[model samples]
Target: MSQPIPNFYAVIPAGGVGSRLWPLSRADAPKFLHDLTGSGHSLLRDTWDRLEPLTGPDRIAVVTGRAHRAAVEEQLPDIADLNVFLESEPRDSAAAIGLAAAILHRREPDVIIGSFAADHVIRGTRVFEFAVRDAVEVAREGYVCTIGIAPSEPAVGFGYIKRGSELIVDGARDASLVERFVEKPDLETAKRYVADRDYLWNAGMFISRADVLLAEIEASNPSLHAGLIALAEAWDDRDLRGPAVDRIWPTLPKIAIDYVVAEPAAERGRLAVVPGHFDWDDVGDFASLAKLNSHGRKNDLAILGENARILSDAASGIVVSHTNRVISLIGVKDIVVVDTPDALLVTTSEHAQRVKGVVDALKLTGRSDVL
Candidate 1:
């Protein structure tokens, strides 16, 4: 018998507050919507565009909070209205995935689903597609296949996946069974992980047959699994998704898909990792963005100083905007100077990670205007 052509579905989780890249990224306008690279398209638009070949406009689903539904829809007009799932309140990724799984399960029982975040940047589309194709084949065999990016550097900010013995499959590159899942490690540990070559960065891109993930969730976090199932069952009974989400989502436990499902599956020898060769970045913070873009030199957009000596070591000119007035800097150094009507941010490229702390402090002091 000829092999069946796989039907693919995608779920994008777009509910993060983007606390790390504040001042630019706020509660009202999240990170995914921001033009971090000054590119016309936002990160969410980039992600959605990348998935066009795999899921098309109709087959993809976006899971976002009610607050951002209009923006999500506006940015992704290609996606149909019915495919958008607006949560009543913001829950973490685990709940988001569960809800997507439940929704897709009701419609297509045998389809392979790809879960992705809206704020990630992925290069090399062809390589990425190949990896997903390989993952689809792996998921067909009942394994929850996660695309694991081979680490190019000792990144301490992301989770790591330990690969086991390689499994040979026909018509696809060899994949490794997941030996274990590790949280973000320290610098020394990250270096060791890179040197061993047995570890890959957890890209947070998941692929599996709908039934497979549901089964794993049932086996691992039965209560959460049950709650998801209940919500799915009653989804059409009433609009139990909006206000009800805030009341019930907090009780769902603050766990990630890795902890609640992937890790346990790895322990049971059912989880696998597909090696990723594509250039990928989660863009978790402002430092990563500046580094990736290399806005480090005086000529770069990092610095905006008055009568300042700007050294051009690849950094661009600084960008400043206040009300209807625009200010441009001619010379600067390894710094970021942003001036808005209500707020101003000035820092060296090295201290961008502290922006989240500033956001937290703002929230604590009720400085919502600047936040």
Candidate 2:
């Protein structure tokens, strides 16, 4: 079946190795390839499942690295081969999203494009679909729309979006003008944000008409926009695209889409946010992952994989088993234990944020094999 909307495309920028969930989320095989929620499908595959309802299976594009190109191809075997945009190396979100927008715009002039992170988790499918439907409506009226998640608690882990006045666009009554974007704040600031009725967690999911998104970029960062235009001209010709991107992709600025596009667009009154009441999480670390799935129990060992034997006596923490091994814990509370064939990680959920530092330490010792 085709999408309900006439012309729409979904762009998933699948970059960044999830270092915090190390030992399981490695460099060669990143977080998106793993099923963090035990949902029976890879995170990347789950992403495809989520968007295929709104924008048919053929209307989606995945922007990933050269190293993981084969993995992405293997995982999403049914997607159009041309829709997988492989970069020579990681040039950050601005280039990735801009390139997708530029190419899609060239083919379908009025297409509404939405950029979603490949590794994010969303519950309440109907709620998510409603938000996307509204977001697409908001984008059609020449606004850069973001799906702002409603805050459930005073969470310091995510950046906040402060919404302003109400928007009166058709089919988007819940849309609000974006007041401004805030960085990840301290605990107290986050508490105040949750207390305030105007704040929502920034999920980094944006929707906009391809031409409008490119126009905003052209006004702010002309060079990057120009490079995207050059790439789009060669996209249809397979032989010409590889050499063109190889020569020009590395020269594009290494910046995030938030700083270069969203924030500025908000300041200029070109940004709109559709409130999403669905449960959402980026799953940056194991501590967060514990909360998302059934692995965050305080009274028992939270086991993620099927091949694990857990015999605990007053021991409570998260356990992820990759190999067929008996993981025994006795009276050691709040400890994080992960057993893999090559490496094992042991830490507490309180210090779960420091797992990325361990990845850095491995880099210092040149442990690329495990990475």
Candidate 3:
């Protein structure tokens, strides 16, 4: 077992209505609260398991919405009151992660914080541990370090990280200076990035000292930094925490860390990327989940849920069954059928990204109960 890093804290930002994985992933119950990987535990629980070894059980905080506090607590029984930072409203990743960072910084000024998403899948614990340890080592050097996944394919679904010259820091020989981060590129750009050998998939995993992150936020976006500082000051007082969230959270900017902190920091030569060669997937949609259980047989159907109720005949696509009834497929190819009690989605692997449009249509047509 790897020893916990000194004063290292893991912050999980678990707020986002994963509408693309909807029907199964709802507003109140997001994708992070579901067991899309068939692990019998929710993704939030899985995230805790991944970070527990590096920071121990007590050093991790899950920043989620106030409504999901009960769910987060229920899933993680060992999580303390202070560790479960509840936001009164959704203000995007910057506010969610920055709030936790500020609170942790106030408690432990020299703490190193690693911010990871709540709904990601990672295999190979030893490799992951090695990368995190290196990240922490780099973080201790007063540099904002991000874990960059080695791109296995030219996948345009994820953003790319351009790696520059290597840093000569001790205990972090593998760490490279981040040139800049690119948004989800087109297929042609993604292919070139993969072949160039200098780009990696932006995994959204970052490790840095609490003060460093806060300072970058202040430099790049001062308004957000002020709101976060105010909330952190009132975090311990229940009387103030509630009112502060209500007032300042909505006023804060709704931007991602890639834009507000990591990207800008990279531009100013303050960001680093530790290349991680692990089997990692964000599981953005049903198709991504299907890749986890794919049989590698083009003629074989991939099942994500209960297999007892599934029987495929001449079908070779993904079937995500959440219902009790039998989900049978006959003669369909490359199709995606997601069955739930409220809604049943039938599309193809090619159109899996369009599922978010269904959620938008439902909202526009006044179908809130299903959404």
Alpha-carbon TM-score of each model against the true structure: 0.88, 0.96, 0.97
Where's the lowest-lDDT run of ten residues in candidate 2? 293-302
Q: What lDDT is obtained when candidate 3 is compared to the true structure?
A: 0.89
Global lDDT scores for all candidate models: 0.77, 0.90, 0.89
Clashing pairs in 3: none
How many backbone clashes can be found in candidate 2? 0
The reply for model 3, stretches above 4 Å from the true place, is none
Tell me each candidate's RMSD, in Å, in order. Answer: 4.2, 1.6, 1.3
Where model 1 places Cα greater than 4 Å from the true spot, the runs are: 1-5, 237-250, 295-299, 302-332
Q: Which residue runs of candidate 2 sit more than 4 Å off their true CA positions?
A: 1-3
> Once model 2 is optimally superposed onto the true structure by TM-score, how far is the C-alpha of residue 132 displaced, in angstroms?
0.5
lDDT per residue (tens digit) for residues 1-371 in model 3: 57898989999999987888888789889999988777789989998998999998999999999899999999999998889898878889988889988999999999999998999888878888889999999999989999999888899899899999998778875999999889899999999999998999999999999999999999989999999999999988978988888888889999988888898889989999898999888988877767666735666677777643987888877887877888878989988888888889998878889999999999999998998
What value does the lDDT take at residue 369 in candidate 3?
97
